[model samples]
Target: MIRWTSSRALPSVDDVILLAGFGLGLSLIVAIGAQNAFVLRQGVRREHVGVVVAVCAASDAVLYIVGGAGLGALVEAHPGFVTAARWAGAVVVIAYGALAARRALRGGEELVAATDGAVPDAGRRLRPVLLTALALTWLNPHVYLDTVVLQGALAASYGDDRWWFTAGAVLSSVVWFVALGYGARSAAPLLRRPGAWRVVDGVIALVMVAVAVSLVAGA
Candidate 1:
């Protein structure tokens, strides 16, 4: 059995556990990364933002459940699996970074025009966009490291309160995705400028490459 009771001046152990999970989840997921850049782009374009947000949040929830259920232990037991995933993920991210860098080099005008054209035809491209979003989420090795291995080990430490911790993490995912996807519209005015788009894409490219290099070096 788990307890949620708290004294007059202190939080209950369960409360502390939940807060910790939420903080950890937020810290990991809120970082600038490939998945986030994709979501922001789609959101700014007003193209399939709902689908993107739903998929990201749902995927996080599923991973959280898997981690809480001990997938982390399974992963730990297989060094070969980790090595393969790391290399594969690094390749994918590096490829993506190269694409982004190419686009950034094309200048802001091309980026703006492309975004504008995509917005009008967004409904026709939903399938491909969704597929890309899924790939971005599932192909990233860091997602597994943060959500599965790290969070799982942390949750396990909570013993009987692990489920509550997982719930908090899931909530954090829901909150962050919703905020990022929906709130991006407010930046439309700024992003309308070609220079702004170039800067954004350049930053995204750098982040992707940096993450890829770190993954390869760690492996």
Candidate 2:
């Protein structure tokens, strides 16, 4: 009556899946970047947050699937890819930094609608979201190393139930984006205040500049 299965030898299946997903989600969410910053800005300004959230979540899901399918190794093998990505990311970070700094220097009312004016038609918005997500997810060798390659490798450690782990990880991105996009709206009141907006934007600018510098140095 002492027969034991592999499942019993380790953590429960659900726990494994949750842990993998939660870890991946948390790791990706920590950094301040264009996509997330944009989302937060939009949320505060009362833009089309649902669509924005959907776009982010959808793009992330697609990339994660590609990674989980084992395409990360290809990215890792290409040093050129990483080098180019770092440069590109640097450009984005610097540009974002400039924008954030401008907003911070200006008053809240001026900054509130800054991002809103930049929105294109529905089609254009979707294009940017997809492209940005792709660049962020694919072009960046780090994403490949972390999400696609490393996460995939870990998921594979589960053998037959790896899919469960993958699903959890994907869900993490979904949940976080939704929460962030929505939660950011709470800052609208403060964002309405010119002084407060300046402070927030100042922080955004600093973060972006730092990221850009780091990228260039690392490259």
Candidate 3:
């Protein structure tokens, strides 16, 4: 084997910072929350999966950039912003949970079953999906705490290397959302029956309610 060991062969400072950013970003994002619950549901339903994924990925990227640019530090100073977000997020999640509970009560065929035996797009409308996706990503206080505050602080620690960290974080976010939304298709086979959808909606409702409680408690 040829010996290629050298300082140049080792990871550079920027490379290390990038990986650190990516690792930290993934660690924070992988936690399941109401937002994730919604995404998984959309993915399983095969409805607006791409829209959900895109919204999440794009929102994360924008937040990361803002944080990296020092918005995180500013947010830390204004605690009221987080407090407001918490209350709003709690209300939104509670309402969403109720909708989910209703769905769980209603069987799958009944959910989108056509009255006239004609094929109909039973999934939710695109505007509502877009709005909900935006709300989940933006209204959630945890998003600011993790992406803006913590991630921003970490990025600032890199000084001149902050942008590299940001790039890595954005990449990590994109990969995660893509995987979460599309990878859910693998479970499609298991969700073909009305019972399976009920179970899923039930679980999602539970997740939403739990998230609401946590938001209130944290506030």
Best by lDDT: 1
Tell me how far the alpha carbon of residue 28 in candidate 2 is from the true structure, in angstroms, after superposition.
2.5
lDDT of 1 at 147: 85
- The TM-scores of all predictions, comma-separated, are 0.61, 0.51, 0.60
lDDT tens digits, residue span 13-62, model 2: 57755664555444445344556667766565456667777776776666
- lDDT of predicted model 3: 0.70
Residues 139-161 of candidate 3 have per-residue lDDT tens digits of 99989987886667556545556
Worst 10 residues of 2 by lDDT: 114-123
Please give the CA lDDT of all the candidate structures. Answer: 0.71, 0.59, 0.70
Candidate 1: residue 173 Cα off by (Å): 0.8
Give the lowest summed-lDDT range of ten residues in model 3: 110-119
Per-residue alpha-carbon lDDT of candidate 1 for residues 1-219, written as tens digits (9 for 90 to 100): 998876577788778668667766765675557787677778777788899999999999999999887843544565455555556656765666676677678864422332353353366577899898899889999899878866665565455577777888898899988887877667545655767756756765776666556556756
Give the least accurate 10-residue stretch of model 1, judged by summed lDDT: 109-118
lDDT: which is higher, 1 or 2? Answer: 1
Highest-scoring model, TM-score: 1
| TM-score rank order | 1, 3, 2
**Residue 62 in model 3: shift from native, Å?**
0.7
Candidate 2 displacement at residue 148 in angstroms: 1.4
lDDT of 1: 0.71
Supply candidate 1's per-residue lDDT for 69: 76
Q: On TM-score, who's better, 1 or 2?
A: 1
Q: Listing every candidate in turn, what is its Cα RMSD in Å to the true structure after a full C-alpha superposition?
A: 9.6, 10.7, 10.6
